[model samples]
Target: MKFDLTEERQMLQDSLRRFLGDRYTTARRNEIIDSETGMSAEIWSQLAELGVIGAMFTEDQGGFGGAGFDIAVVFEELGRAGVVEPFLDSALIGGRLLAEAGQGEKVEKVMEGALHLALAHGEPGSRYDLNHVETTARDGVLTGRKAVVMNAETADLMIVSARVSGDVADQDGIALYLVDKGTDGLTIQGYPLLAGGRAAEVTLDHVRGTELFGADKGYQALADVTALATVAQCAEALGAMETATALTKDYLMTRRQFGRPIGTFQALAFRMSDLLIEMEQARSAVINAAGYFDTDQRDLYVSGTKNLMGRAGRLVAEEAIQLHGGIAMTQEYELAHIAKRIVMADHRFGDTDYHLERFIDLSAA
Candidate 1:
């Protein structure tokens, strides 16, 4: 019930805040985001050098002995700075899964001073149910299509989920596999998204890999890890909302209309005030949900965080854009950056509707 970060977590947050101050800026972020690879290997390597890429893994997994809250702290810092590195895709999803599956050898190699693995779980048909994996794995061969996989095109490796000899919707038969990039029969097609980030359609035409985690209730692992992932995302979304609100407020203060600053106008000021309140609520939900995850509350906390953050993130993003007027939509303005991050927040684990339904199902049970 208490929402306070311990000394260790605060230290982690402060370290990331300092590191991001020196390493990332709007200009640097823009350059990396618009680059040929749509990411910065140099920055990613630097994160590894700082031991942040593996900050959430355990010592047994060859990591620096960290946890979900540590990872969430990093995500908050990244969101505050608009850094476009692959910590979420790599360390959170792919690396965490491998670490949990007891793939120490792979981690020792792949996670050595870098973490940029991708999760190839989503199919064109699966929507947000990760258990609904249509990708097939039989006799060491994987064959199926993955759509809009974040960081797949540039990741060093991928942790893919596949159905093993059963219907796609069966939760018990799914397995997680580790596949090297550019393997034979793996076709990757990259494209730019509306948010200017990159995602790829990955087709595994009988691709082969070793099974890292099989049908031994890894679904529980997946659920727990994904809950942590969702809460971390909510933190990021809250950060984005805070940033957008600041930008809007600053613009209002400086932008003149009739005879004084537009911020002084009652109508606009009230709207900004409302947004500030909403942003704080969203932030509280983020911290509370994160604390719940850390405390091992399995059922309601994850869905609660997703719901609160989904609504708050969307509301703040939309209001910030509206308050900024036409300038917000244009790429020339910085508000667009926060806005894009907010827009992309919907697909992080699942959209608001998806999580709400999940909450309902859990409540019913």
Candidate 2:
């Protein structure tokens, strides 16, 4: 299958790369991550103005491109820059969920960057199970805890998952609610993550929420959204791996020992070659996942892609750091952040082991 992007997507990629290259320097990203919100409002607004957020949705949802490839393209660029923006949370996952629930106005607000959203789905000990929701919603009130909610601290709105009926791990009777920030009985404990981002521990006790797309029905949508996020993360890891490999190559060529560049040694050169091979395989997996998204077998492909990316990302990050010596471990260098992001991307949505198990389960079915 042809993986070439259309003209529109190509232009979008070029424009976004140029913009990020000009503005999103390592120092600037550090400042953003160190800020109170752990993000740059100005950069978010600029992304919106460039139609970056809008591109993640379909035309029906007021976006020009909403295909899996669109999401992959945007996220890959973001990953290459090591950007800390919340596009995956706000636009790809939360906005798409609202759009699927027929909340067009809310999606539009999110596309405009006037609203920020977090999905409060993961719970303590949920362990990558989308259906393992201990949070309960009854009588339009939510009561329970959500752990490690990304962007919840600064989000203007939150999409929460709760069980309205049935057991905690049952797929049926899973529901979603729309809760505004600062609501009574809603508490958010914000903290920084080791991966250079922020997350919150959200607790709700008798906090009222408006049902999204009716009550006690959203498990399928949640599953689909999670798969989409997983695919986007695969793309992001591919980008980071690409950067890491290139940096390692450059370092080997310039850094010399015994009156010769280290790259001249067969051992180091062979390792670099192996890294390139892994990167290529990871790229192919990402492309396959993007193509399969929106199809009946999307979940299967997503799981496979994420598993491959996780392995590839870990290999690339470790080798890049080792090959570059101690300099790659320091925060002052760009490769250090890129490598860290690549490694951490594997843990989101689901880790390598999680996706491998899921892939086997889906294949058996």
Candidate 3:
């Protein structure tokens, strides 16, 4: 299972890396985070113009006819830049939801960059179970609440997952609906996360929406979407780990203590070597998951990748901070941004603990 990128993929990765280097910076990132929405509309438009938003969609929807791996490459570059454009939420999660749900109009609108989209999947009771939704949709009305909805404030279209009225647990009763933002009886209260990203609490008081997708092949699309998004996150985590480790290595080489560079200290150098080993393992798992995404064995690979990458991301971030001393926590340092985002990424989709149990379950099955 070799996961080597083709020449085309390598070219795409290089282009995205250059674009992020030239366009996104620490100052601009801080400014965007300080804004009310914690994102930049102009930057998002620029990304759309560059075809970053629609890179994973088919050409029928005005996209570039790319795959999940292509989107993952872009995500890695975004992670290296510490960007908060909600690209993963809008382009990867929301756009894929629309496509799987067969919302042709919504997919077209989002692909054209005319409308931003968000997915309402997490709920208080679900506790990171993507299918354990309590929200209910009946008679064109949706009710219940969602928490930790990303990009809720800026999205024009919302894809909501809800339990079909009178459904059983672990069953195929979950349905997805399309609701326009500002619809009557729908309320969104949002705030910035500890990371640079933003999330919201969504409440639907009998909110009305059109059913976009129902249980197809036993509501399997939910799992597929989450798996696909997790692979993208693995890509981001790989980049973050690489960047943080490189920065720490450079700092250790230049910063002198006790008449020698800190990197000369065997203790710190060995720890960094361990981190590199974990990062290489994570890279392999991420690329393998991407390649196996559409196969019947996808869940196994996804769980394994999530577990490995989640640990690598958390470990690299913590190690980066520890090596940098107090300056690492300061907002003025790029390491701080990377650390926070990495911590957030650790919990996104599912945390290490969550993925461990998921991996065990899949393997047992």
Candidate 4:
């Protein structure tokens, strides 16, 4: 299959790249990371004006291109720039769930970047299990705690997962609810993440929420939304790996050893070649997962793609740092931040071992 972006997607990619290149410098990103909110409302509004957020949803959801490629294109650019905005939380996962639940007006606000939403699903010990929901919801009341909820502190609303009937880890009886921020019985403890973003630990004590769709329908929606997020994350990792590999190649060409460029050395040249090959393989896997997202085999492809990306991201990040020596370790260097993001991306959604296990189980079944 052809791995090239469509004309419209290509245009979107180009425009986003130009915008980020011109505005989102490393200094600006560091400033945002150090800010009280850990993000920039001005930048968020600018991105919305550029239609970056809207392009991630379908026309029905107030976006023109909600396909897998559309998500891949937008996130790849975000990763390349090391952006810390909550677009992934607000647009991809939260917006998709809201749209699936028929909350069209809220989704429109999300698409316009007028509102921010987060998915508070993972608990303290859930470990990567999408079905491990220990939070309880009954009679419009929610009670539980969610761990490491991305962008939760800044979200105007949160889509929380809770169990209505079945035991924890059961796929059935899982439900999602929309909880407005600052509601009674809700508390959020926010902290900065290692990868230049903010996350929160949220506790809900008899917090009342409006259910999004019926309780019986949330399991499938959560599964589908998480799968899509995993695929988009893989694309982001691929972009970061691409940047890391290029930086490594440039370092090899410029850093001299034995009165000559290190790239001229046979061993370093071979290592660079290997990294390039692995990056290409990872790219192909992302394209395959994106292309198959609408098919019955989407879960399989997403699992396999995430597994490949997790391993590849680790390899690329480590090798890039090693090849660059001390300069790569500094926070001021672009490579340091990009490599950190790539390494941390594996821990999100699922890690290499988790996805490998899932892939094996699915293949056997």
Kindly report which residue pairs in candidate 3 clash with one another: none
The predicted structure with the larger lDDT, 2 or 3, is 2
Candidate 4 per-residue lDDT over residues 154-234, each given as its tens digit: 899999998998889898998889999999999999999888889999999999999885668888998899888987899
**C-alpha TM-scores of all predictions:** 0.93, 0.98, 0.95, 0.98
- Cα TM-score of candidate 4: 0.98
Question: After superposition, which runs of candidate 2 have C-alpha atoms over 4 Å from their true positions?
Answer: none
Candidate 1 structure quality by residue, lDDT tens digits, 1-365: 55667776677678877888777767777887788778787777777766666666777777764565676677777787777766777667777777777777767655564546888888988788867888888977899999998888778888777888667687788887878988999999997665555889999999997787776654666776788788778877777777899899999999888999988999999999999898878877776776666664655777877887888788888989998789898876777887889878887788888889988887777
Which 10 consecutive positions of candidate 4 have the poorest summed lDDT? 210-219
The predictions' CA RMSDs to the true structure, in order, are 2.0, 1.0, 1.8, 1.0
By TM-score, highest first, what's the ranking? 4, 2, 3, 1
> Pick by lDDT: which candidate is best?
4
**What does the lDDT read for residue 322 in candidate 2?**
94
Task: State the displacement of the C-alpha of residue 321, model 1, in Å, after optimal TM-score superposition.
Answer: 1.4
Cα lDDT tens digits for candidate 3, 1-365? 55677776687778778888887888889989999889888888777777677676767655765476876777788788888878888877888878876677777777667788898878987777776878887876899999889999888888888777444355577888889999998999999988786889999999998887775432577777788888888888777777888889898788889999988999988987888888789778877787777788888888888888778888889998888788788998888888887777877888889999988998998
> Per-residue CA lDDT of candidate 2, range 59-116, in tens?
9888899899999898888888888888888778899999889899888899899989
- Candidate 4 positional error at 213, Å: 3.0
Regions of candidate 3 where Cα sits further than 4 Å from its true position: 1-4, 60-62, 215-218
Show the colliding residue pairs in model 1. Answer: none
lDDT for 209 (candidate 3) = 88
lDDT of 3: 0.81
